[model samples]
Target: MKILFVEDEATIAETTIPAFQKQGFPVDHVETVRDAEAALSVYDYDLILLDRVLPDGDGLDLLAALRRAKDATPVILMSSIRHSVAERISGLDRGADDYITKPFDRDELISRARSILRRPAAMSRRVIEIANVVMDIEARSLIVGGTAIRVARRELSLLEQLLGARGRIVPREAIERNCYGFDDEVSVNAIDVSLHRLRKALVDAGARIAIVTVRGIGYMVEETV
Candidate 1:
């Protein structure tokens, strides 16, 4: 899944962004509420890590605006100074899915992020199964016909997007946004290249699923009869 990390601390961003990338989640980082809004307007993210303070204004204002617009994207409000009970309550009352204080463990942050995604309201299950293929999202592993398959980070992100759709077409634009970070220098044929490798890997693993291209449109995952 794609994530928007609205953190200004250089030290934290340096470590956290790589951690999320290592887990196969593409992250777009923005330091200000204005930049976050601009990024939100262009891309769709499965999770948002919103810092309570920003250079321009309080991050809660951005969260409140999103809620006002009826955007239900799961958000984890974070702060280093606002760790009081009342502050946490205020954040949740402002429509945050969760609240986390700074100086937290990266693993714990990731765990909490996964927890939010698995919630019913988020619509992202920990495990997704279609036909004989099973994807353990938390494990970042894919199993087909009882055999484990290894996929690259970008390919895994792509697989998540397609498989999460459950045989429905995933638009090309959506795929591009979901699989790449803001700083990534993606090639013109990056999607096609990654997809080709993914298709080969699945076939080599004897999977009974197919990744179909829609020509001038997008792609879909289908079960082979």
Candidate 2:
């Protein structure tokens, strides 16, 4: 996940940036509304952690501008000034998805952020069946047609990543980062080997879908059409 954090508090930014990074999320931190605007122009973020109060402007203004420009990225307002119900209403009405009062627990914040990103609607069904392949996320099982296809732990993780991506080609780096945490020793050819083995297993099991190689790009799981 990629996140943009707009906060004027140096201590908070310092603490949160590494925390999110440790969780395999890339974070860009900005202290002022001007920096936030500038950063938004250059990068696309899956979520924005915005402080409701900024040095140069109100955070609500930035949220409004983003909406005006058709940037629908989820924004969660982090504020110390929201003491009343009206304040919360204003923030949400201006485009914030959720709000966190000041002095909040970092873990809670992280959970909320993940929840927003992984909303049920954003992910595919509990069981995604493409072609003759069936992935049961709730059961953590894979079946091809009527037979079970055994996959390694790493291979299962790779498949989950691709399936969660909903047909979009996921890059090699993303797969590596998602499967193995940041400190894992992963070789450049590791993903290729995993994909090769996975393909063989699926093919041998008569799976209908194939993991298509996109040639120097990445891999995509799609129907055999």
Candidate 3:
């Protein structure tokens, strides 16, 4: 998962950046609300980790702006100064999905972030649908016409990565990270082989979702029609 961390605390950013990166999460950091706004305007982050207090403006302001713009991407607010019940409630009211008090356990923070991401979006969806193909995320399976389809573990991971993308584009880098672990000896041809097999499997199973290769960049899944 990719994240945008809007924090001014040097210590917290320094510690969490590498911690998250170690788990295949790349984090982009911004210390001020203006920079946060700029980042939001350009990039799409899976989750936003925002600080309650910033060098330029209150975190609440940024939250309010996002909501006003109808940006419903999940946001987790962190703060040492405003972790009280009322403060947290206020943040939630302003559109923060989850709030974490400062000095939190990194594991706990990661868990909360993943939990939010796992839940079906009220505005979008967790289970992806294209043509007749359904990705049943809860069961970690795929189905077409109510029949289950078996996919290899790594290939299933690849499918989930593509289907879970809010945007259709799934970068080659992300596919490599999600498909193979550190101990696995993976090569450039690994993705091509996996895609070829997966494409054939889905076709044989009668799915109408077309996995389109974007030439040099990545892949996207779309309805065949």
Q: In terms of lDDT, which candidate is strongest?
A: 1
Per-residue lDDT for 4-53 in model 3, tens only?
A: 88889999988887676555555778899999898788666678999988
Clashes counted in candidate 1 amount to 0
Candidate 3 global CA lDDT score: 0.79
TM-score of candidate 3 relative to the true fold: 0.62
Model 1, stretches more than 4 Å misplaced? Answer: 123-125
TM-score of each: 0.91, 0.60, 0.62
- For candidate 1, the TM-score is 0.91
Candidate 3 residue runs with Cα over 4 Å from true position: 122-225
Per residue, candidate 2 scores C-alpha lDDT tens digits across 24-99 of 5656778899988887776666789999899999999999999898878899999997769999998899888999
lDDT of 1 by residue, 17-112 (tens): 999898888999999999999999988888999999899999999999999999999999999998789999999999999999999899999989
The candidate, 1 or 2, that scores higher on lDDT is 1
User: After superposition on all CA atoms, how large is the RMSD of candidate 3?
Assistant: 6.2
